[model samples]
Target: MTDHLPRIVVGYDGSASAGAALDWAAEWAELQADEPHEVRAVIVGTAMDPVLGGYRARNDDLLERWRSEAEQRLAGTDTAPGQARERVEVRHGPVVPELLRAAEQAAMLVVGSDGHGLATGTLTGSVSQHVARHAGCPVVVVRPRRSTVANRIVVGIDESPEAGRALRFACRRAQRTGESVIAVHGCFSVLAHVLTFDGAESELAARSLAAGERLVQEVCAARAPDFPDVEIEPEAIPVRPGQVLVDASRAASLVVVGSRGRDAFAELLLGSVSQHVLHHAHCPVAIVR
Candidate 1:
C-alpha cells in the first residue's frame, strides 16, 4: 500500500528468488524505524496463449500453499517481528502487470532474481525485467543465491540525472553495508557509429564516448568521494553500458538503475538502458528516481 516512507513490493510465484526477496525486503523494511514500510508477496497469473507456449500455472490450492509458505518464510527470517509494520499482499492477475500495479503504491520494489526456476537451481526469468521497464517506482531485483547483506553496490553512470540518482542511491546503500561502490559507464558504438565507422563521424563518436566516460568518473568521484569506512571504487567500462552493468552485477550485491520518469531527463539523467539492466541483472537492482 501507499505510505510516507517507501515500501517493498515483491512478486512471488513459488520461485526461490521471490522467497529470497521477501527475506531481504523484510530486513530492509525494518531499517526505517520511524517510517512505515510494507512488503507484498504478489502472484501474477498468465493467460492461456499458444505464443507463450500455453504455459499456465493456475491452482487456487497452490496459490494458498504459496501464501502460507511466504508468510512462514517472512516470519522465520524477519527480526523484531512483533514491532515491525508492513503488509504481505497476495493478488491474482498477470504477473508483470500485477507487479507494476503493486509498484504504483510502493516507493521501491524488491524482487527475486530469476523467478523462473526449479527445486534447486539458478532462477533466471523475465518477470523482474518486465517490472523494471514499466514499474511506477524503483525496482530492486534480489539475488537469492547471494547473502542478504550487500557485497558491493554497482551503478551505471552516463552523467544523466537518472544515473546520478542511481549513483547517489547506490552510495547510500554502500554506506549501509559498509561496502564499496563501483560506478560503471559502459561505452560502445551506436548504430550510427557502425554505419560511419570509416568516416569523420567515427572520430566524433570516439571522442564523445571518451568524454562521457571521463564525465562519469568525474561525477562519481565528486558525488561519492570519501566513504571513510565504505570504499568507493569508481570504474569505467568501455563497452555497452547495459552489458557492462550486467557483467558487474555478477560479482556485485546490488545494481542500480533509473526509474525512467515521463519528463525529459536533465543533462545528468540516465537513459532507458539503465532501466533495462534492472530487469536482466544478476543481482538486486535499485532504481533511483
Candidate 2:
C-alpha cells in the first residue's frame, strides 16, 4: 500500500465549488511535479444507520453512486495528458470527521469554501472552516473568484514561529510558480497591545509602525537568502493584520497565513486574524499549521 506516500487530499462532492477545488488541487500537484505525490479526491457520504452501526442497503447504494460520480468528475478534471489518474476514496460517515480521517497525515488538504451535499450530501458547507481549524495538516480553502491577480502570493508576517512557517510555505510556492511574494505586516493591532500612552497616542502609533516595518524587513530578509529567486515585497501597513491581509488578497493568486499569530490564545486552534482572512479573503487562503 502506498499509504505512506505524500498525498494532496481533496474533498469532492460533485458541487461547482468542489469542482473548482479539484482544479486548484490539480494545479498545485502539477507545480510539485519534481517531487512525486499522489492527488486523491475523497468523496464522503453520510452513514444512514446510527444504531445499526455501518452501511445498510440504502447507504451502500448511496455510497456506490457517489463513488461513481466522483470517479467521473476526477476523469474530467483538466490535468495534463499522460499524468497518473487521481485516485478516488469513498468513506461513509459524518462529512467532516471522515474527511479529516482521510487526510490525517496528508501533505495538504484542499476543500471548497462551500458545497451542496451529494444531491443531498452535506459535504462542504462550513466543513472547510471546521477542518481548517482542526485538520492536522495545512488546509487550503478555495473560494470561487471572479478575477485573480496573476503571479502573486500574499502572506501575513510576524515574529511568531507560525508566521515564519507561513512565510516559508509562501516562498516555496513562489519558487514553484515563479510568483512574487508580498509579505504584509500590520502595526496597529500589535501596538495596541503594549502601548498605553494616552496623550502620546500618535507618537506611540508611529513607533509601532516603525517596529512593524523593521520586523517585516528582518523576517523577509532572513528568508530571502533561502529563496533568492523569490521576490519578497515587504509591506508594513498601519492597519489591523486581518484587514491588511483581506485587502491584499484582492490582488493575490493565493493568501498564506499562520494558523494562529503572536497574540493567539494558547488553546485556540486558529487565530482571530487567520480566521478573519479565511472568511473574507477574495482569493484562496492557505492556513499553515
Candidate 3:
C-alpha cells in the first residue's frame, strides 16, 4: 500500500450480503477526496489440518477452488475508472484474526450482515461482530437492502467520545457526497416509565425527551459550523434510540453509530443500541470506535 492512499479491507465470502459489502466498500473508496484509496478483498477459510496427511491433496484442491471463486467475485463488481485500486487476498485461518490483521493498515474494515435474525432478518454474523469489536480502525457492516436515495447519513449520538468520532466521520462523508446528516437522539427511561405513577411517569418522560433534544442540539451545534454546507437535522424522539435510528435507516444512505455508548458496560465492545441497529437497520451501518 502507498503511504498516500488509504486502504479499505472487505471480508468477501461470495454470499449476497458479502457482495453488497464489496460494492459498498468500492463506492465508499471512490468517494474519498483527500487521497487515492485501495480496496483489498480478503477471503478467509479454515486451514486443512496437517495431521490429515492422506487428505492434504484434497484440501489443497478445495483451497484453490475457493480462491478462484473469490477472484471471480471480485472481478464482477463495478469499479470506477481511475478510482480506488483493487486486489483480492485468500487466507487460511480463523476469520476474525485474519481480518483484524488485514485491517491493521486499513482506514476502515467492512463486512456484510447475514440477514438471518428474527427482528429484521439482517444480523451481523459472528465473524463480522468479532472483527467490528476488535478491529484497529472503524468497521462498517453493510446490510442486504441499501437505500437508493443516497441523500442522508443518520448518526446515533450520546455523551461519548465514540459518538463524537462517529459524528466526525458522518460529516466527512457528507462533505464528500453532498448528503445531509440526521443527528438522532433516542430517550427512554424504564425506571421512570414503569415504576412511577401516571403524573410522575409523564413528567419523567417529558424530562427525558427534553434532555435528549438538548443533547442532540448541543452535539450538532458543536460540529455544524465546520460543515457549513452539510445540512444537519436534529431528531429527538421518545422511543428506543436503536429503534428510531433503525427506522431512519430505511431512507438513509448510511447509518453511523458508536462502538460503545454511555450505558454500555466497560467490558462490552458494543452497546446494546449499536448492536440493535447493526442487526435491524436497512442501510449500510458504520461502527466507529
Please say which candidate is ahead in lDDT: 1 or 2.
2
Task: Give the alpha carbon lDDT tens digit for every residue of 40-77 in model 2.
Answer: 88888766555565436656676677667767766776
lDDT of each: 0.66, 0.82, 0.78
Better of 1 and 3 by TM-score: 3
What would you estimate as the lDDT of candidate 3? Answer: 0.78
Candidate 1 minimal-lDDT segment of 10 residues: 116-125
> What TM-score does candidate 1 reach?
0.73
lDDT of 1 by residue, 16-111 (tens): 767778877887766545564666666654442334532333354566677788777766765443433334566654566667777886767777
Candidate 3 at residue 3, lDDT? 41
- Give one clash count per candidate, in the order shown: 13, 2, 0
Candidate 1 Cα misplacement greater than 4 A, ranges: 1-5, 33-36, 44-58, 80-86, 116-124, 144-150, 189-210, 225-230, 259-272, 275-280
How good is model 3 by TM-score?
0.85
Name the runs in model 2 displaced over 4 angstroms.
1-4, 50-65, 77-84, 118-121, 190-201, 266-271
Q: What is the TM-score of each predicted model, taking all chains together?
A: 0.73, 0.86, 0.85
Q: Over 4 Å off in model 3, which ranges?
A: 1-4, 50-84, 115-124, 195-201, 266-271
